[model samples]
Target: MLDQLRQIADGLGQTLAPFCEVVVHDLLEPDQAILAIHNSLSGRQVGDPATELGMARIADPDFTQVLANYANQFADGRQAKSTSIGIKDASGRYIAALCLNLDLTLFRGLQSAMNQFMRMDTEGPRESLDPAGGADAIRARIDAFAGRHATTPRALRTDERRALLSELRAAGLLDVRRAMETIAAHLGVSRASVYSYAR
Candidate 1:
């Protein structure tokens, strides 16, 4: 049952690859941390944090906060909306759990469309990330960028912003172009708007 759930999540991740990333974790042993799968729009595989380059070691002090998040949210699947249907053996003793890390922003639109078309909420219960918080993060990043480069009205040009965004991606401040899109979406504007600001 656990394996089946993982496969299902993997398929969903692939299907939704165009707009977001999906991550799966096993909750039976929260610390075990199996990254069942992740798919990205930029065709980048989500690497295990432990093995990924430049990522702070999972064993670092900051790992405690990560663990706390896992225990508080990931383990329960309540805030995460990942679902924790028990994985049990034939005898019914609990074994493990399955989690789905869905991108709420993108999925919500598809879900609404499906609900409208089906005339029902086939979209199950959803726990979504704080889109507002994400937006604020982008604003903060923009402020930081402005501070770094002496931003002024003159700096806010389309081509300049695009170049800044491109530079940020190259510098690893942003991992993929989708990150730019996310920031743009959060700004309640087009990617072009964010690109202009980036200048």
Candidate 2:
């Protein structure tokens, strides 16, 4: 049974390799309970004494059979997430245990980087990505419309230009001063073409 447990531990360790350590403890041998250790993240050897939790399982059969995602750390103080499962014999005597400890440093680092990359600037660029109705807003809306088609404003087809102008006219964006020139310049068209499309 202990050998079978060791094989299972080795399989689990390989499956979660580089970041996780899988340890099997022979609860009956508290003095040297570690029957197998794989992935070796915790720097523990096979002959090491059982942990306090293992001792608890030995001292009390009623101890929790499974403790999952509990906070833990390595001797080097790196953070870890752990899950422990206790096995019992036919007579309900606690016999062995399997524990997996996953290092969280890499995950935490990735989380930190994502947070940094996604963080918006609170101190620079006085402009807003979503401004209220104005020339800036009109420009932002037009740019977005073009972006939806995976193209730039200046590259929109004549029919697309007419549709965009129609929308701007309905939205009263055309009422702004120099709106026609603005649209013409932004769309890389002549002012006469803007007037023609606005119809």
Candidate 3:
């Protein structure tokens, strides 16, 4: 199982360009879930005793209330956003978990900036409307977005652009229809002008 996990992790690292790290944790023992299959961590591992217990007892009916979210969601802070999946055995028994931590600070930052814009009474030059924090804030959003979407850093075609936009919307970064309009406006066009691009 450990060997198979390693192969899966390695394949994930290859397939997902922004995937910076992959860690597989064995859930066989409740107390030793913290042990990494391959220990190459630089800082303190992210672990909460309560969270571990919550994951270990997933079969318990009450555990649902304890941890309602077991899927990916945007996290805020220096290290935010991870693609996490709970691994299960053939019999549908929980066995382990796989966490693929990707750099998404820019996407998260852009969402924050958008929120700030929505709150303001007016819209003007982006720089003029920027928060008092200035470039640091802007950089975070841009960095996160670029890192998360432009993994290859290659120029994206219209289809790629639309695909990425769709992903962002699904991730709750943008509204379904409004996001289309926003992208259209960015390209100096209308919503109809972008549909073909998406196709």
User: Which candidate wins on lDDT?
Assistant: 2
lDDT of 2: 0.90
Q: What TM-score goes with each of the models?
A: 0.28, 0.61, 0.37
Candidate 2 residues lying further than 4 Å off, grouped into runs, are 122-199
Which wins on TM-score, candidate 2 or candidate 3?
2
Quote the positional error of residue 12 for candidate 1 in Å: 2.2
The segments of candidate 1 whose C-alpha lies over 4 angstroms from its true place after superposition are 1-5, 18-24, 27-29, 40-82, 106-199
lDDT of 1: 0.48
lDDT of 2 by residue, 1-199 (tens): 8899999999999899989999999998899999999989989998999999999999999999999999999999999999999999999999999999999999999999999999987898776443233667578768988998789999998888888988898888998877877788788889999999988
> All candidates: CA RMSD in angstroms?
20.4, 11.8, 13.2
What TM-score should be assigned to candidate 1? Answer: 0.28
Model 2 residue 88 lDDT score? 94
In model 1, pairs of residues that clash are: 161-199
Better of 1 and 3 by TM-score: 3
Candidate 1 per-residue lDDT, tens place, 1-199, comes to 6677678767877786644344444434444435465553223232333122112222232221122112122232323222233344565444443333443554567889998888846487865465443444445665666567676423445655666566566656565436666666533467677656665
Model 2 weakest 10-residue run by lDDT: 128-137
lDDT by residue for model 3 over 1-199, one digit each (tens)? 8568768876776676552455666666544553342222223253412234326545542232222223443333444445556666776666666665555556678899999888954575554443333334323433465476654313445566566555554665444335555555444556685665555
After aligning candidate 2 to the native by TM-score, how far in Å is the CA of 100 from where it should be?
A: 0.4
The TM-score between candidate 2 and the true structure equals: 0.61
